[model samples]
Target: MREISFSVQALTAGYGNIPVVRDVTFTLPKGTILTLIGPNGAGKSTILRTISGQLSVLSGTVMICGKALSGLSPAALAREMSLLLTDRVRPEMMTCFEVAAMGRYPYTGRFGRLTAGDRQIVRSALARVHADDLAEQDFLAVSDGQRQRVLLARALAQEPKILILDEPTSYLDIRQKIELLSILLEEARERQLTIVMSLHEIDLAEKVSDLVMGIRDSCVFCSGTPEEIFAGDTIRHLYGIQEGTFLTRTGSIELPRTRGNSRIFVVGGAGFGLPFYRALTRKRIPFSAGILFENDLEYGTALSLAVRVHSVPAFARTMETAFGEAEKDLLACQAVLDAGTRIGETNAANARLLASARSAGIPVWRTIHEQD
Candidate 1:
């Protein structure tokens, strides 16, 4: 088994003698990636600040490598852990290189001068984050995305055993978010670095976390593997999400289906119906979709956005009874939409539905844009 990196026991933490988070606890092994998730003001940042030794622990204990958090000196703590928080660092006269090199201060001598070895590590860190080009530029003048990468580089240059981040992906674009998280994963895998962070992007959190802890009501509400935490309305309840539901299979979110009048019958399956469903939802056009296999890629979205979905077991044949029901619904609808689902030998019933719609003089739209 890997060594335990950090342990929190019955910790009550906040600023200035008041506790914002109470009785939080977890143990992470070396190389473990743990994510804290919840709605805003759930004390995730407070918990992170306390464990990282930036804020005082109101009660209980925090241990890093078997050493008490309060017992470790500033230099000792810096050597053991690094942070990239929402807080901005504006170094007036420092270049990005100098700001990044500050991460080596834990190892620097009394005068805080960097040797050739330290400079090399700093450069390598900048390159790892693809910010080497900005090394000569002033830290304060870079864009937020570039600044985020530089801060990450600084944290990496620290080469600490544990990293604490709060909303580390803030101000990052989609591509930057992917690259930064991928780099963190690589670091954790190759260097045995333990990570504890809070992310608003639960989808990315679900993908990257080894252990997920849900923080709410000023305490640790749920802590388990990502599978356990993300399974079945747990996140919905965790965040009190009323607008849309969380999709477990794909780790995505979908807006609620409209219940207004003028329903449209849709024939969709095999991932072909996603855009049509979203477009309908965006237009506030209520729809009933059907004939999807339970394992279809868009099944979750269909479930969330469709007023009533007709589905069959994955790999099972579409029976005549289902076809009869769908045809009835189709004829009763104002129109039918064909999401361009292929009519294979198994799902050829959908083709009959389309034919039935045309027979009844109901509009058979080959594309949703026809109605648009």
Candidate 2:
């Protein structure tokens, strides 16, 4: 069997004799990433704190490298793990390099001064996170994104087997978030690092995690591979989503579609329809989409944004034989958008829609917009 780099068995974590999270059990092999996801106050951070040895575990055991976390000496554990939490740190005018070198505390001498080798490690860690340029600058002077990278470099400087992070993407822009996660993923693959972290971005979590755990009501609601855990109504139920819905295809949340006359009929397929759907939504235009194969990339978006979606089984030649509803929808709309979907053997019916619109004197445009 592959060696388990980290494992938790029935871990219950909280403060002052009260349990905030309980019965959470999971194991991660080397180079694996595990992410915790839940609504706010769902105890994700609490669990991370306990396992990282910041907060005491109320019950159960956390094992690092086949030995219990409690049994390992502080220096031994420090050598095996690096942790980054969300708690604010106000470094008093410290240089970024000095901040990163703190990670070498486990190896530093009794005087707590960094040696030449330690300084070299710190410099390399800063460079690894692309923040070596900021090494001489005041930690407080950099942007939030740069500070976040520096902090990650501090964690990397530990050169540990496992890493623990809480909401690592906070205070980062969309592009920065992508870069950080991409770097972490590459580091995991290259270094055989075990990772545990919490993420509010379900889309990124789905894309990045080797395993996923959903927390709710003080316990684990479900745990599995991203495929198994994100199926059906799992995410919707996990976060008690009411105002919006979790979309499995996009791995994101979408608000309810506008309610009004579906005055526009869209002929969309493949991925051509996605932006059009969102554009219509942004304009608050009520629209219906149809004739999409169930497996098309935009079908899920259509279902979320369109009032009445006319669909058929994937890859079926239903366009030739079962064009009743689409024809009916075409007649009721004020305009038709082609979405410029390609004509093919399976979806030749869309051409018929365009032809029918022109014949009926209903305006058909390759694109659409709300009149200003």
Q: Which ten residues in a row have the lowest lDDT in candidate 2?
A: 363-372
At residue 40, candidate 2 shows an lDDT of 90
TM-score of 1: 0.96
Off by over 4 Å in 2: 368-372
Best by TM-score: 1
Per-candidate TM equals 0.96, 0.93
Query: 106, model 2: CA deviation in Å?
Result: 1.3
lDDT score of model 2?
Answer: 0.89
- How far in Å is the alpha carbon of 50 misplaced in model 2? 0.7
Candidate 1 has an lDDT of 0.89
Off by over 4 Å in 1: 368-372
What is each predicted model's overall lDDT from 0 to 1? 0.89, 0.89
The digit string of per-residue lDDT tens for model 2 on 1-372 reads: 778999999999998799999999999999999999988999999999899888888999999999999988889989999988787877989999888998998999998898889989999989888898999999999998888888999999999999999999988999999988987898899888999999999989999999999999999998999998889998989998866568986786677797887888889888888888888988989999988989999888889889888888887866655488789888889999888777788898888988998999999888533321
